[model samples]
Structures are given as C-alpha cells and as structure tokens.
Target chain A: MEKGGFCISTMASSNIAILLTIGVITVLVIQIIYIINRSRKPLHSKSPRSLSTLIVLGSGGHTAEMLNLLYVLQTERFKPRYYIAAATDNMSLQKAHVFEDSLLGKEAPEEVGRAEYMQIYRSREVGQSYITSVGTTLVAIAHALWLMIKIRPQVILCNGPGTCIPLCVIAFLFKVFGIRWSSIFYVESIARVRKLSLSGLLLYKLHMADQLFVQWPQLKEKYPRAHYVGRLM
Target chain B: MGDIDDIAKEKRVVFVTVGTTSFDALVRAVDTPEVKNELFKKGYTDILIQMGRGLYIPTKSTAENGSPALDYFTFSSSIADYLKSASLVISHAGSGSIFETLRLGKPLIVVVNEDLMDNHQSELAEELAERKHLYCARPQTLYKTISDMDPGSLVPYQPGDAKPVAELIYRYLGFPVD
Candidate 1:
C-alpha cells in the first residue's frame, strides 16, 4: 500500500512539472510573437519626438567603424546619447569624447554636452581563457543589468563587440517584462565580409535585435534576416 | 610634421603597418634581404614600418646593404599621416588600415594574418584585390607581391557612404520621412 501511494505521488509531481514546462513555453512563444508584431507597427507622431539612445563602443576597429556610422547619424531624433565601453578600453573612451566634441563642436553651450559616457567590466578580455570567464561573465551581467535599469534607453545600437551581449540581454528582459521596448539595431562590422561576428551571431540567433544590417551582400544571403544596406565605413 | 611631409614628398615611401597587433610572421617577412631588395628595385626610396609590438626588427635594410632608407616604430598616435605620406602601403588585413590607404589613393598590398581564427578580413582583402583595388598576399608571398605590383594598373576604391545606413536606421525605427 505504501509503495503504491509513493508511486502515485511521484507520477502526479512529474505530471505537474511537465504541465509547468508547457505553460512557460507557451508564454514565451506568445511574448515573442507580441514583440515581433509590436516592432512591425508603424509608429507615427505629429511632432518630432526623440529617443534616448544607447551606443556600445568596442575597442579598435569596432570603435572606428561605429564612429563612421555615427558620422551621418541623425542626432536630432536620437538625442541625449549614452556611450558605453569596456573598462579596460581607455582609448575607445577618449576617442568617443573626441568624436562627441567634434559632433557638438558648433552647437550651443547647453547642447554641447548631450551625451553621457560609461564603462562596464568585460566578461572576457582578449586572449582570456573561456574557463575563467564564467565568473566574470556573471559580474558583467549584473553590472549591465544595473546600467540597463538606470538608463532605460529607448534605442540600443552596437556593432561588433563583446560588451553588447550583457546589455542586450537586459534590454531584452525589460522588453519581456513589458516595461519598454528598447529597439536594438545591430550593425555587422564592415570587416566581417563573409560572416557575422560572435555578438552578431548571438543577437541574430536569439532575435534580440529588431534590425540587423550586414555590409556584405554575401553575408546577407547567408543570414536571411539581415538587411544589406551597403557598407557604412 | 610639415618637415616630414615635405621629406616624404621628395622620396618615394612604402609604409608597412601591422595595425596595432603582433603579426610577427609579417614583420619577419618584410625584414628580410629579399623583400628589401625587391622594394629597392621598385624605386621605393624609403620604407617605413610600423611593426606593432613585434619582436623582430628589419635591421638588414640599410644603404650599405643595397636596401632603401628603412626605419620602424612600434606605434603611432595616428597612422593617417603615415598613410598620407606613403606612395605605397603594405598593411595587415585590417579594414581600417585598408580603407585609410585606399581613400588616400595609394596602391596597397594587404597581407592576411593566417594565424587569426576569423577569416573575414581575408575575404575583404581578396574581394578588393579581385576588383583591382589592391593586391592581397600572405606573409610567405609578400616578396613576390612587392615585385609584381603595378600601382598604375589598380583603380581607386570608392568609399561607401554611411548616410544610407543612418536613414535606414531611422526608417526601421518607425520614424516618418520629413
């Protein structure tokens, strides 16, 4: 009698677990469908409304290409910019400032400083081993979570960079919670002629980015979702 | 800076840059007698190399050794001035280095770093080379590339504009056209 009762209890618990899994999966599918539909909606406003923009700058070539992309950026619509770089990358931070100064060089005094720059810890440094990066990755995620919550940006832009992953995840979480939809625009680096960068791959696979731009036409062919809008740099 | 520009104008300079990374094989390849002799024969009066933290130095390049006036530096604040001064540029397959040189209308030979796992830059170099914008070579074939390069035969690369991208982004975000 005891054995039979124990088997029944175990079977009931297993059934409940399976039902819970299905429920979570169903909710996820619905959320994804809703988000996709929401992004497709043509938003129209009578007056010029601005979005608080977030730009993540990676080191060296990534920063160079992003600056080129920003060269023709319509700053009027994407104002009050926020720039994020990795903590170890001091040069990228300096370059960002220089680019900002040049951008607002001719503007009014009050509008001179329309951007904010911040740095976050990297999950893995260049040449770092993957084994130890798990610990740092969690740290980076926590810090990114804090920044994403604090800024609550409406638009997120990043090219090829490792730093964008954590922030994009948090932005995605915010979207999932229905707090806000921080539309992500991922631009594949011009250097990536044949393939997507790791960050690009992750965001593309997860459908985290609302729009993904590939510079190379062949790359666009490989990744159907990517829009081939010509090379930016 | 003005003096350097004036000096560069008089002497044909071939600037070799690894572009902020250690490509020891490339540095070692260009530092050889065969490469130096080839550059000298091409009427390149001077060769300036930005070695980029590489341990090997091209010390064999000297007038006594029948090579052109050669000099190398580890790093520079900006390589734009160097690109501007160069009549020819042989650079690592970095897009920034490639575009900078091409925009200046200099003949270029891009040397691909085979050690790197990412083969994307190789495609960029190869594609541009196929279009006759620049020549592409590995460290091993650099000597032959330098010998056969015809700067006159190449066409200048038309740089792509970023304005379309900006417009696309705005449109994708549901912003209406004015």
Candidate 2:
C-alpha cells in the first residue's frame, strides 16, 4: 500500500510539471506573435495620427513632383501619413486635388499651410518677391525646431527650393540629436543664369542635398550627390 | 491671378499651367509665330488662359493662381473642384501634372520646359508624347501643336503600380514593408 501511494504521488507531480511546462511554452509563443504583429503594424497605429513625412512643396514644379511622390507613397507597402508645407502664394491646388481623389485607399496628405508659421520676410504681395518674410522665415525655423521635438519624422522628403534650406538645416540638426533623417530635392527643371540670384545661390547650395533627383543628366554634375531619377514627370 | 479667373468665367476656355519655372525657350518654340498662326488657323482656342510660369504670347494670358495655399484639410476639397472645371488642360512636363491630367482623362498638351540650364523636361515630354499618352510641343512649335491637337486627342492616362519613392523611404528607414 505504501509503495503504491508513493508511485501515485510521483506520477501526479510529473504530470503537474508537464502541464506547467506546456503552459509556459504556450505563453512564450503567444508573446512572440504579439511582438511580431506589433512590429508589423503601422508605426502610428497605436499613436495618434502623426506625420510620417514632412514634404515641403515649392511654388510650381516642385509641388507637382512632391505630389507625385505622395501618390507613390500612398500605394507603397508601408504607408505613412504626410503633411504639406507649401511655399507662400503657391497654388498647389491641383496636386492636392489628385491626392483627395485617389481610389487606392490612400488618404491625401494633410495640409499644414504657412499660416501658423510666420513668414520671415514681408512683401507687398504674395509671389511679388522670391524671398520669405522675416516672420515666415522665423516661423519656419521655429516650426522645424518644434517638429524635431514633437512630430519627429523618421525622414524628411523636401521637393521645393523655397523650403529646402530650412528643411536641410533642420534635418542636420535632427541627425545631431540622434534622430535619423534624409532629404530629397526635385530638379524639376534646370537653372538659368538670370534665375541665379542670391536666394538662387542659396537654393543651389541647398541642392547639395542628401539625395537629389534631377530630370536632366547635367544636373548630376552640378549636384554630385543627386541621382538622375529620369525626369520625375 | 485674379484677372485670369475673372476673364475665364466669360469665355469658352482652354486652361494652361506650364508650371513656375522659366522654360522660356520651349514656350517660345511652341508659341512661335508659325505655331500661334497655325493654332489660330485651327481655331483650337476660342479663349486661351495660361497659368503658372512661362513666357508665352498667348492670344490672351494671365497667371492663374495655383489656388491659395490652404491648410491640407480644406485644400483637399478645393483641388477636386479645379480639376473638374478645367476644360482642356495644357501643362508643363512635370510628372505630377501629367499624372493628374492623365488620371482625369483630360485633353492635355505638354510643352516641355527647355529654357532651363538643362533640357530634361523636353526629353521627358518627348518620351511621353512618343508613347501617345500626351502631345508634346516645343516653344517654337507651340502654335502648331495646339492647332493639330483635337480636344479628343487627349489620350487616356496609363499608370503602373510601383511605389519606388515610397519604397526608397521605407527601405532607408528599415521598415519591413516594400
């Protein structure tokens, strides 16, 4: 009777051990799957609908290129929300229109116009001068600083001459702050001598961007860092 | 900008936006005396309105406002309105404009911007024109191209499903998605 009792106790203990082992293994497997799924989901799926991209739109051609890029991003495997920082007086309405009308379950980029942002320079009228208002410029710089602190995009894709200078400066700062950032410029068309004024010089230097997309091959020489993306038209 | 809109309301119109860069040479070629004469001969422009940046001697011209930049939420609604209203769209060789034009199935004539330091827009415009997706005009031939283009000749736009730019961003960021 004693031997039989001892045998029964041993068997019961082994069974409990086996059950505990299985339970632990099951729990671990579930944890692994949860982690995998969390990683696979959109970065902001849990967070508020934050901007994944800060795309700056220049007055004309650059606006178009950036819009096209937005469309491309909407269809990509990884969709991140984007915000448009258009140049002052730029009527980038058409590109915005395309985004609003996409059928591919792509939401158009949210417009964060220059209103809240101050113009660095004041002009008698919009587009009268190529320069930004002092207020607007300060606002842009401040916005960049704010974005680094708040929105904190993984990368910035800049497409305009107007904001390239601002965006690049911010991006460099972000890199220093241990945030990863990259930039892209659209050479929608080539530069001319007459268009090569002071701001133009600044813009040209700004075009020494991290990654430049030029429609023409000659632009490659001017910007060794540029990639000839075969005319983004 | 206001003037163009005010004038456009009264006439049977053709809307042109060649973008904001100075592609003067290309515009000049397409709108050459010969080209303008041809278009006039063809009667394509009952009224022509040119917008954005270019130096074309239009039968009538004004820089149409792009649409006042608005916050994204509101601007989205207005952009659709502009696209629906444009009758015949003439645009620069910018991909965004072309894609929008194609997507709308609007009659389009793309005049490449050649006056830039480099002539990339010309090449792109030509390649696309060769595909029969759009009509290409140089500045000197602008009038001739306009003359020859039938409102019906604006070919339906074709698109491929590749997100190269987005992919580039994702890959750089080490996202698992393509």
**What is the fnat score of candidate 2?**
0.13
DockQ of 2: 0.08
lDDT of each: 0.85, 0.50
Error of 2 at A140 (Å): 4.6
How well does each candidate superpose onto the true structure, as a TM-score?
A: 0.90, 0.49
Q: Candidate 1 A-chain TM?
A: 0.85
lDDT for A107 (candidate 1):
65
lDDT tens readout by residue for model 1, A47-89: 3478889999988878888888887776767877899999998
Runs in model 2 with CA error above 4 Å? A1-52, A59-61, A72-84, A87-143, A177-233, B1-37, B40-45, B48-99, B102-141, B144-162
- Estimate how well candidate 1 is docked, as a DockQ score: 0.54
lDDT of 1 by residue, B67-129 (tens): 888888999989999999888898999888888888889999999999998667898899889
